[model samples]
Target: MLLFNTAAADVFYKQPKTCPHCQSEHYSLTNHSKILRFTILPVIPLSISYQRQCDDCGYMTPVSWYALPTLEMLSIIKYFAGVLLLGYFLIQTVLGVHQQTTNEVSYINKPKLFDTYFVHADKFTDTPKRINNLKVAQLVEFDNDNMTFRVGNYTYKYNKDIEIAMRTSMLVQDNYFSSKTMTFRKEQIQQFYEDNSIYKIMRPELYSLFGGFVMHPPKPKPLYTGVKLDKHNQEGITYFKDGLYTEALNSFTLSAEGGYSWGQLNLGQMYRDGQGTQKSLEKAAYWLNKATQQGNLKAKIELAELCLSYDCSNLNTD
Candidate 1:
């Protein structure tokens, strides 16, 4: 419940008079006090009340409907209006400053992928020492369709396998860790692209151009089980490739539980293929849909295939 009241002591009306207590000729009779109240219970009065007083003698008397001088009333009105306007402007200024400070701190705290790293294509070699010795160059452009990029005046091309790896790395960097979380905002993505060296560091192939620089990819923090989710996902992929479906399923399950999209997609595929698990279209669709929500194109394609082949009319393929 909200309750409030306002009280004002102002000279509503004044007149020259002789003080009864002080017996002074310089006495002034004035109507002063006023109060207004609002309460949840309707017991409080809403009207303003006033009282008259002798300014010199401090003698109080009852007042009934005293008339205020026009000039004095205008002066009181101007004073209150000025105070309210100043308070409003002060509040607005404080809020604006607070919002600006918050934005500045947020920008300062955002994760940065690299610090002063540069690209080098001409120094392509097989030795780590040579790669370290190579001078850094500035990157120009990247061609997603051709899987090629330009650093300085040199252009480098990568194979389809490398392209897939690069894209996977980008996706993992974007989704696997909170520090490197990606936003869908075009302005933010553009800012990241322009301000960071992530594009050059994303692919080992790009690092190969710098004489196999061999910068290790960033990994997620280990969980309570002392295993990183990405490691489990990678292990699952390796097991799957080696035809170890049962082991792959275990690893993928752990990874999927940890919210790894790669593992989710793989687990969905295993469920669909009946590899180390009973084939269940419902389970496949569920896991695939989970992965697809995280921008997993492969999972989306698999989901589309499942929808097409099984005539899953209830599924939202789009």
Candidate 2:
């Protein structure tokens, strides 16, 4: 159970409404809030839900749409909390954007040695055919008419991982840069800025942090639907491909809990391999059995192999 889930009684109604379970005329409305907190104090209201409890029978049911409270009728705590929480972040974001814009404008106009230019991967002549979206080009030489850059051999897909794009530690000796160099004409550089292809320009000092404002967005809560489960399974596969075993395990667990057969199979395999969590043959058998029950042929084969190594006679594979 979460630590800060709290429900508060809001209003009491003695109207001519009857409870479905028991014919009670008295009911109390309550608000259940999922809160975001700073230490012990509630900072923001993440979500709110309403329920109606019968006074006599103590039967609780979700409040009906027609009987729900209006926006004005709701508590002011949410609005007040939102203002306090968002105000600081808003100010920081604005300041950060201002600083970033000033740096970009300054760096672009005056070329300097080893100044980094964030550009589309396609701008590099020898970028891998895998369609890596973002690439860094460090300024090496420039004159009045043309500018040459030592393009990093690595290319990356543009995601939340902004810092990794400019990390010098990623550069290795031989494969760091190609023997050939890419040069852009002065007019082409101007065209790239006009077309928004040259996204960011910064010095080595700015590489430590990528975004203007420092913030870590929360991972979304998993939904228990077929589509959502499939997405989780796919995400798990991607994580596993990237050797992020812990993250892969988490995604697989969410998908498996939603009764996705592929997720169950993958989770069972991970258990067998001890990829993220400790190996447990019992847990492996349990998940593989679940997937097998759903007619997953791969899981059946894996379970057969697992049984050969472990004593499956007493284990509850079902």
Candidate 3:
């Protein structure tokens, strides 16, 4: 339950004043103050009235407006300092977010090195686990068609309560374990922005305050077209060619979970053939269908063959 009440108090301060009743210069200034309160806490000021009292005779009279010094008025203004500070803080926060958003858009279009993007990890892959969903991708290189990012190995759970300090940690050097990088098409990056998958972008220049270059000089790492997902898919193919079906299946599973259509197709075949696991037509159809949706023609053929025995009517073959 909420309890509200107004309480008044007379704040007395020593001030030079001539009391009308006593004709004495020794007087105290007092304000008849009332405040709106919630429970035991004062919420706001309601009203205030000023008067002067002679200390020697205990006589009270109205305050004289002409006698109040400029410094005294400034003292009264200090009472509203809390309210003023609160207003300024709120305005600054709104402007800061707006300016940062503008900077992100500008940075994204220009494609600078070391520009960091805070993104949803699940969106980066097709079958992502929820245990760790918040991730960051730092820009490494870009071309007309595609842009590459060094993805962080470490991930955190996303929530509204997560603070900026936690998010900023994603950009720290050690997070990009094993120098893993992922490349995305320019069109896909645009789609990510449209879907709000990328929430914040921080530029390399922001790290100068911490002496980023002087602390750790940038070393040129060789760029490779084979990202993690593609590498997994290729590894599966090599294992399959070498008659190592179990290893092929394991690699394919990793690749498929990371959103590789070819990996999905190969993994479906392994399930159907019972190479590494039991032959389950249902599982085959499920994975094959996923690949087919991503425009993999080989998966369509395999899925159609699997449907010859299983119920194609229940699957999304079209």
Q: Between prediction 1 and prediction 3, which has the larger TM-score?
A: 3
lDDT of 1 at 211: 37
Q: What is the C-alpha RMSD of each candidate to the true structure, in Å?
A: 24.2, 29.5, 22.5
* lDDT per residue as tens, model 1, 194-257: 5542233322343332233323445666657643449899999899899999999999999988
lDDT, residue 26, candidate 3: 80
Candidate 2 residue-wise lDDT, 179-289, digit = tens: 667788977877786676778877764333343311123557767544333999999999999999999999999999999999999999999989999998888888998
For 226-289, candidate 3 gives per-residue lDDT tens digits of 5344999999999999998889999999999988999999999989989888998888888999
Off by over 4 Å in 3: 1-15, 32-47, 62-70, 158-181, 206-318
Off by over 4 Å in 2: 1-40, 43-79, 123-129, 158-162, 165-168, 206-318
Cα lDDT, all candidates: 0.54, 0.71, 0.73
Cα deviation at 271, candidate 3, in Å, is 75
Per-residue lDDT of 151 in model 3: 72
Error of 2 at 133 (Å): 2.9
Worst 10 residues of 1 by lDDT: 145-154
Model 1 ranges with Cα > 4 A deviation: 1-229, 311-318
What clash pairs does model 1 have?
A: none
Judging by TM-score against the true structure, name the best candidate. Answer: 3
lDDT of 1 at 136: 23
